[model samples]
Target: MSAPAAPASRADWPEIRTGIAADVHAFAVDDPGPLRLADLDWAGAPRLSGHSDGDAALHAICDALLSAAGLGDMGEHFGVDRPEHAGRRSADFLAATLRMVRDAGWSVMHVAVQVVTRRPRIAPRRREAEARLTELVGAPVSFAATTTDGLGALGEGDGLLAQAVATLVRPGDPARPA
Candidate 1:
């Protein structure tokens, strides 16, 4: 038989999208807190300053998910001006974002997040963080951390930063094997 006919168009393949995002928050000098990051509570570390719990990692992940789904960023969905979001948990943000992504007819394939911080070391807790995030998002989640090598405000340990990338695909798409 002759060579199989070339796919009629790109539409023959399932749609896939990727998104990248980042977030940063400075330590809260006024608020003494049980620091929350990657959905875990750090008893001794100081908390980050923000209207929410200041879990930069989760916030970045939410933004990435929203971006991938073409649903806009976190600010539009949960703005500081919204009094209800004040002091909200980043986990709540994550759950809401996941819901939004699902409602958009897309499912998360995976997510990778990198945290930039000088203190409250991440290696010791990477596995735990990954497990928790994976459970929350219903997808594979990777968590990693790095330092700025003493270059800026982040290097000074004044704040925490996080970056995330997410992949999404339509559920049950022919291109996606069960």
Candidate 2:
């Protein structure tokens, strides 16, 4: 075979200061009762249980973004016992998260989320879910789904789990080396 191409140097990469955060959230369906999975928006899908809409995906995403910006977590900002957030929607959470991140001098660059569930197959509506989340966050959002292969509670179809990673960047910050 011909010689392999050399890897690009660090200088070749874009000059930007970026931060990353990841979070995971899992809830048993029986804990909080039947609540909707906001992203899926499918009527037949098994609902999650939580104080809000219980969209694990959105909640995880918000947590990740907040963590990345050193802004604490979802529970601290929107506590379970807070009556004001009793029946809030995941979309509202997302909006508030974006605003908080912006106020902290960071902008969301990208978001990726993976949800694990055994019901209402995600492939059919994956695109719709991604688009909706993107609109809410004003950033590109990627969505994925998986099953536990009958291994654990998720595998046994008891609940859903979601994990998210967020990339944030601070622009025009002199502290960041160009």
Candidate 3:
């Protein structure tokens, strides 16, 4: 029998002339005992624990952006084991992720983040959070807050959770090397 034709590689496929990519990510962090600092800055609020500042919202956004760009998740890019990332601010992570995405030939279109927690009500800081994220990503960012209705770890006031979606666009032809 004659040899079968091999499937075409991505390089041989038709180029994407123009379009946008989107992705979503969810993350949660528990209290790191009584000593660690939390990412959210609200008095009397329990902190989310992690090697970094543990801002669930920013972590989710970074993961979403990386996913939208076909890049690895946050853990791979910035693992807890990496001493350099220790105690790093969430804003710094967001900035670094944005730079990586741009280097990969994509631009941010928008970002939306939703936080779930029983403590540290986000409503009061919604505008400030959105403004800060927007400034970091250099694009419009939306913030939403919700509670788990006294049902989960968050409801129990043990931690915070966040979910985010990011839209990215490739301005030029995709076939061209980034």
State the lDDT of candidate 1 residue by residue for 13-120, as single tens digits.
567899999999998867888789989997657998999999999999999999999999999999999999999999999999999999999989999999998978
Cα lDDT of model 2 by residue, 1-178, tens digit: 9997642554343333333444333444445345455354565554566788778888988888888888888889999889899868887888898899999888788988888878757888889889988888889999899998989877877777877888887645344444
* Top TM-score hit: 1
Whole-model alpha-carbon lDDT for candidate 3: 0.70
lDDT of each: 0.91, 0.75, 0.70
Please give the clash total of every predicted structure, in order.
0, 0, 0
For residues 37-96, what per-residue lDDT tens digits would candidate 3 score against the true structure? Answer: 113466556455667777777788888888888888888989888999997887788788
**Candidates ranked by TM-score, best first?**
1, 2, 3
Winner of 1 and 2 under TM-score: 1
RMSD of each: 4.2, 5.4, 9.5
Q: List the residue pairs that clash in candidate 1.
A: none
Q: What is the lDDT for 2 in model 3?
A: 100
- Ranking of candidates on lDDT, top first: 1, 2, 3
Weakest ten-residue segment in model 3 by summed lDDT: 17-26
